[model samples]
Target: MPYALTCTLHLRRQVQLLSILTVFSVIKAGHVTREGEVRWQLFNECSQGMLQTYLGRVNTRGFSDRHCLTEFHVEADFYGAIRLQHAQSRKYLCFNKRQRITLRFNGDSERCYFYERINHSGYSELESAWQPRLFLGFNGRGRFQSPDTYHVKRRCFYWLKFVRYVPEEELHHCEIRKPVDQHVRLEHTNMAHNALRNSLLNQIRATHDGPYKHQDQENRNGTYSL
Candidate 1:
């Protein structure tokens, strides 16, 4: 092939790749960490498995071992900031004036909260904006209270662990996702991309050829086909 033809093919391929990238970006923006609501399951590595809503339930004011029934899916902001709220009770976990984190039944004020993974491990500790030293954890007894003191027996035991949670709706949005699902999705996307490219190129060719055909016919006969 001539150099000019080779260059034309390369330019066309680049444009096609750019268009595919643009489409993927628009489709994926909704699923990134930036958009929609993100959730994390508060898992305790040593104590009760899951961290749940420790609302003013009967004998469950602080923290409990109940799994899903404890309620309140966690909501996190950018930079790993988080707030736990019970759906039915409409209560939010807020830091109180006592320098401890507590469940507030009703409040509109936004408090500062940040969480970080410990040693790049799955286990994480949630930190509060007001109290710098203390973390969100259960005390000597398994309760969901951020006491000022650390656990004397095992300091690492009480530190909270987190797993980025996906809601049921989100699950439906992506069925084939697992730890290795991203690579699969990319492969599937790339494999199917050629068909999409062919369709787009066909549409472009039809659009470009129409006007030129009409102009050529007019020049030959000095008349417009109505």
Candidate 2:
């Protein structure tokens, strides 16, 4: 074979391999589905609790705690960017100047957005869109990835799994919700976790005060959407 032809073929092969890698990267960087009212429940394995909003502060709470507060309406575009709004307060999640995750009434701010990346282990990590270096994690906690740090086998605290939470009353809309499972599942077998997260938030207290009063009223009217 001519030397020139051999060189051309080698370059062409490299180009093809690059194209394939690019496509695979796009596939792995999954995007958020915009199906209406499809909420996502964020569970932190280390904390063993669900991420919930309370009085505009973000924290993890046990499953038996304020249930609706744990659910969030995630809005996203085709590029894997997401914004989370508390299911009850309708408040969007945002990071303050101090890097603390808090709730805000407006979702338009850049601080409210996050870029989600799913690890090969099938768990997901959320990094702030406004401040790329910072990630969502427990307040005053979270290790930042850096050149000096060595990767470890244990899961990082910032890594959290999103579980789909659908109320039994919405069973009629199951078909509409199916499309989002692929992104939420990410090849991880969390059937038991899903079952526990999907349990209805039926234990809301009657004497619940503060923000609970507003949510309780909305629940009673059965008009709450998202």
Best by lDDT: 2
Q: TM-score for every candidate vs. truth?
A: 0.44, 0.49
Output candidate 2 Cα RMSD. Answer: 22.6
- Cα deviation of 217 in candidate 2 (Å)? 61
- Model 2, residue 110: displacement in angstroms? 0.9
Q: Give the per-residue Cα lDDT of candidate 1 at 5.
A: 67
- Residue pair clashes in candidate 1: 62-144, 63-144
Model 2 earns a TM-score of 0.49
Query: lDDT values of the candidates?
Result: 0.49, 0.59
| Highest TM-score model number | 2
Which segments of candidate 2 are over 4 A away from where they belong?
1-36, 64-66, 139-156, 159-162, 165-226
How does candidate 2 score on lDDT? 0.59
